[model samples]
Target: MPAAPLSILHVVRQFLPNRGGLEDFVANLAREQARLGHRVRVLTLDRLFSAPEMRLPARETLEGIDIERIPFFGSHRYPVAPSVFRHLGDADLVHVHAIDFFFDAFALARPIHRRPMVATTHGGFFHTNAHSRLKKLWFDGPTRMSVRAYEAIVACSDSDARLFQAIAPGTITVIQNGVDLDKFAGAAAPEPRRALLTIGRFARNKRLDRLLATMQALNAEGPDWRLRIVGVPSDITAAALTAEIDRMGLSGAVTLHTGLDAPAVRALIGQSSLFVSASEYEGFGIALIEALSAGLVPVAHPNDAFAWLKERHPLITLADFADADAAAGAIRGAYDRLARGEVTRGEDLSDYRWSGVAARYIAVYKAALAEAGHGVAATAA
Candidate 1:
């Protein structure tokens, strides 16, 4: 018999009104959980980091999930929000995203709330090479202790799994972030697309500068190639990105869009033939998979997550973004292959479907409840 529905409380620092890989992952997962008959509530901070002046609604329902925003102090890296405890009181299981303050706080509060807790390592703080020594020390000391409190630890990619597995070998599971395949499915034309598209938040590790350099190299090839960049702001500001674009002499050839609606994004995908990203790190490359779902050929930088992807999906083209000429050469080769009908679109990506990913989480939640003696199905096996 199917198990009774469970009440899920998701904890994340950034959410809707905040657009990025982590935010999108939580949104899509919560939506799917709601669809599967789970009562879902997300507890997040009140402000979007990009525009701190603009506050999100304190309480509201979005995409079928109940979300409540509480005030947070401290930096964006580790938001100190003790008030989240008030909201998560009703959840059967607390599912925390990222290894931040919430992950630690909820684990510490587990003894009081007496609810099973689980967390997803959304790339961790290893997104950049910043503070390598301190991060390693923290990972070994504090991160290890916090992880011991979780019923399950989901690593969004193989790379992440390997990292967490070293600390919490027994509890880690690899559930790659799911893509909304239907969102842009079959949006790309069969022939190679002429324009290139890149999407994500403007993090420094995204290496947008390297992408611009690649564009300059492409321009030297004498093709009238244009690039469109769509993303929200995080570590980098919009003004800074603009200055860099102008500095690269790409002001005339590049178009930048922020806060675009899904339809608008889909429209851009329909008009473009290629998708590219020079991201130095990613928990899992959701945008790249979304592009592949749209039937766009992807030229990705060889980050650990993207490298894991390239091994499974043979169509993905990996280029070393460290060198502009080399990256540009890869892009040019991808275009030529498309122009000659050497390859086709519509790659099969059923394995990364949300239904499968959400199902895994649902089972994980059930096992968590049973283990916590909350009276659900017994055995994770």
Candidate 2:
């Protein structure tokens, strides 16, 4: 006899189309799990994640998974819906994304219900600057309370796991963010030339200014490279930084596109000679891996979670943390070095495919269930 598949309810803060990384990860995981014969559903916040835009229906079915978007509130940055607990009664497991942001749901979900609840802490405000001292204090207080609710914690990278443990101090599972290889199959890298690319929200932590500075430095040496910055930009940050471009005389060298779909974003990355990241920190470098799978070399400051991949693959370049300028200089130097048959592109990326990733997640799911005192039958095991 075969064992029955577990019914899962996944909770996320929001799921807008243009949101990167976590949105895609959650969507893929939900869809793939359904395809693998598991019952899956999604519950997210109702409000639009960004500026006035078409929102998905408040309640709908997507690829056989039930999706319910509800209105909940804590702050402009983090929202929650208490109604999630009502629907969770039917699920064998409850998976939550960005634990710190959606703590309200955890409070609504009582341990007396006995369903295994796993929380993945995607981001925290510890690294962000609060507008006031009171806001900073309030943020940390809520975060600590949230971390105490989870039966298990998941961190997408080793750095995130270590960081989570430092604050929460408990067992944390580290999982690498995975990409859908098939979606990038037809996308091809353009002829290698003086072109570079990067994507992210235009915030201080993203350090888009550093990438622009790198381009200015490279053009100063006469490589005449062009950079395309594809991402949503915060109005305040954009207003503050636009003058810097004119000051550097890089008006023609840099372009910023506000939003794009997944295919469009991957196509843009595919055509570039290299993918660059100047982030001060990252939970996981999803775009870096996407660019690498699309056959573009990745250059960034060393991130501990990515160290394993870098050691095994020569396709990535690392910059010194103290000076992003040196990192930019090295990337330009890598472009020069490419002509000697040193750079590789369009490498078969089946290894990073979501199917492989789904298998790993299933293993974690089973392990989590076991830890919570659920015994899956031997056949399923």
Error of 2 at 332 (Å): 1.5
The lDDT, on a scale of 0 to 1, for candidate 1 is: 0.87
lDDT of 2: 0.69
Question: How many residue pairs clash per model?
Answer: 1, 0
Model 2, span 1-381: residue lDDT tens:
126777878887766543666777888888887777788888887665564344567788765667888776666565545666566657877888875455544644456566767777665443344564754565466655666666677887766787678657767877667777666554536567677888777766677767877887778768578888877654234555667777878889887666687778776766677778777666676777777766667777675645655775678788753464687678877787665667766665565677777677677677777877886522232
Please write out the lDDT profile of model 1 over residues 223-243, one tens digit for every residue: 588899999988999889999
Residue pairs in candidate 1 whose N, alpha carbon or C atoms collide under 3 angstroms: 193-273
lDDT of each: 0.87, 0.69
**Candidate 1: misplaced stretches above 4 Å?**
1-3, 189-191, 377-381
The alpha-carbon deviation from the true structure for residue 303 of candidate 2, after best TM-score superposition, in angstroms, is 3.9
